[model samples]
Target: MKAPPPNILFFLTDNQRNDLLGCAGNPIIKTPNIDRLAASGVRFENAFCTSPICAASRASYLTGTSEKRHRFTFLTSPLQSAYTDISYPATLKMAGYRTGLIGKFGIATNGIVPSLQDEDAVEKMFDVFDNYEHWTEEGYEIRQPDGSVRHLTDITGDKTINFLRTHQSDHPGQPFCLSVSFNAPHAQDNDPRCYIWPATEDHLYAETQIPEPFNAHPDFFRQLPKFLRETESRVRWQKRYATSEDYQRNMRGLYRMVSGVDRNIGRILGTMDQLSLSNNTVIIFASDHGMYYGDRGLSDCWQLNEQSIRIPLIILDPRADENNRGLIREELALNIDIAPTILELANLNVSDKMQGKSLVPLLEKKKVDWRKAFFCEHRFHRADIPKSEGVRTQRWKYIRYYEQQPVYEELYDLRNDPHESFNLAGDHRFSNHLKRLRRRCDKMSAECA
Candidate 1:
């Protein structure tokens, strides 16, 4: 008889940067569990989100399509059923995988959630869905039947462990897929605390000082284009990083929240070991998108800059050879590639409609021709957020704000200016390079559409 399909466990964190974890070479953060996971798996050094926002990026992860193809972003109408019906969870369920979702179901379907009453619609996607959002206004308290209050992060871990236990008890023979999406590390946005973590993590970085952000000086803020300087990113910067004290507190809080999530990941892995499931499970850890901790005088993610788009991506399959362990791949992996990767891991064929390619071959160390670069875009139209798209290659990044009166453009030589401190679009010497990138950007936008 053929061997049973491996169980899949996926963990997605909110607003986390690629360099925060110890495994990613950050010297200050406490993420031991995640670091251990990275040491045993393949970590993608250059993973990015096509759209650097929750709604669009999460939708891309689910549907294996770009935001341009899926057309789902904040304040937009609910995602079309055609796309939701083909979501990774839905497809895995159809293929005999018992799927479960815990924490923030960021996408809306047929209705915006917390107001969405259609239980049948959600049931079609996840067999066990515990959907929620960040506890911004009221704080992160969930009273249990025992009269004890628990943090939202702890409750999320409880639910995940409970899912593993219940699955083992109810469906011992069936392989499962569990998605644990954590709302930690994302700022409250409305709360003055900005970033909140469990009290347990209050002392993680109590004495260490956070380094000054890239281009954090007032001169950098003054030099920005008027449209960008007046945007919400700057508004949030005032709220979170207006002072050195504010910057230190908020950055430490974000790292503490990340450490809190790391603790829970340890709990989940422990549960897998206790249940004898460690040998047959594949685990993936990533974030929807990266956050800007006052990078370039920005607070939240909206622009296609490195700090806003780069995310942490790690995949560990227990069946892989020992040589593949601890390997770090400097490949250009996108959030959209996740669904296809999960499907391929379960021995299912990837759909033609899915724009992303499977990452299984990369994990196996197979000699496959991989993408050298990828398309990135942000189409959310708002006064504070501009509508723009771009093409990012190994050494260059070209962005265009098509909605601008004169269509403003930006070009960065990523090789020399990885921080993207200088704009090369106006430089006459790189005119040919600019023209080539512009045409490539247009062609990519068309292809994705």
Candidate 2:
């Protein structure tokens, strides 16, 4: 007998990177739940976001297209001219699964500088998030709640719990998809003090080792703009502490925030177990992109380096295949592939318009030529310069800004120059390599087009 479709509990985080989990090799940040997931599921060692900015990357994940295709480059607008384009979640509904979305939507795509962020614009972004109240048999309906909502992460989890509580057994054994997004550890207010994390130095144990290109970039501020001098928190913090005492304070707090969400995830997982959905369910945890945490002279997660583009992706589907349980795969994966993967998991029709290939075959141990370079892009400053894109192959990373920026090119040999301190774009020795990387950029742009 053919088995029923498996339920999908999709968890998404904002402004997150790949190094948070102990399983991902950061010893100090405690993410027992995320680590547990890593231990039990396949972890994509080379996963990447299609774009580093919040809105553009989130839109790419939703629409299953490249930034060039979706054209939702700015946060406020829908992709291109199509407001009703069938996003992956909406497509799940076509495949006979109920769907729900909660938490941060990364809707701020218009190049609105943070310094000039209008109060009204922030409210508008918040409104787009709650515009679609909930889904029903009739159709996706508009919605607004009268209850006081605080802390986007808490609200996101609560909504998921509420949806689960209300929709018990509504599927009549058919599978459902629940997209629960959290805004934790994203520095919501742009102020570290505004962070809700409770992890402190006294409670934290010894600092865990974090591997990086440079032991420390203490002089990061020397090259940064004056306004962004405070961006080099990592370097400043490093100089202040004699040992690893508070080295992990901010990081431990991030872990606590992740742990907060993980606890809720545990509850959600426990709910599935109670409902007897474990044997036929798929759970996924990933982020739109990563954060800098004061790395490379950057205050936030807007940079295009591996620190900002590399994100964590895990898939745990007991029904998909039992053979790869607790198995970790190092194959290159991109956010572009998420659409097809989800569609394949739901046994639904994957659109021809989708650019990513499914990981189902790879998960099943089937051989395929996956990818060597993970493509990523960003428009963080949204300055007069139009665009910037990056391509990271297994050994090297190349980045180019396409417009009026003063310094517009970068190339790094990940194996040797991990800090990306030296830009080789103008070097005669790497001219051939630069040509190759430029060709890659053109190819990716064409593919995305």
* Predicted structure with the largest TM-score when compared to the true one: 1
Decoy 1 TM-score against native: 0.97
Please, what is the whole-model Cα lDDT of each candidate in the order they appear? 0.89, 0.64
Off by over 4 Å in 2: 81-84, 108-152, 190-192, 198-216, 220-249, 320-322, 384-387, 405-407
Q: Model 1, residue 131: displacement in angstroms?
A: 0.1
> Could you tally the backbone clashes for each prediction?
0, 7
Model 1 Cα lDDT, one tens digit per residue, 1-449? 99999999999999999998999999999999999988989999999999998889999998899999988887776677767777788889989999999998788532227212233556777899898876544556566799987778887999999999999999998999999999888888778788879878977899979999998888988988899998899999999999999999999989999999999999999999999999999999999999789988889998989999999999999888898998888789999999999999999877787999888888865567889778999988688898889999989999998898999999999999999999999999999999999999989999999
Residue 240 lDDT (model 2): 30
- Give one digit per residue, the lDDT tens place, for model 2 in 8-91: 777888667887777888766666777777666677877888787667777777667877777665644444423224467667
Candidate 1 Cα deviation (angstroms), residue 241: 0.6
Clashes of 2: 7
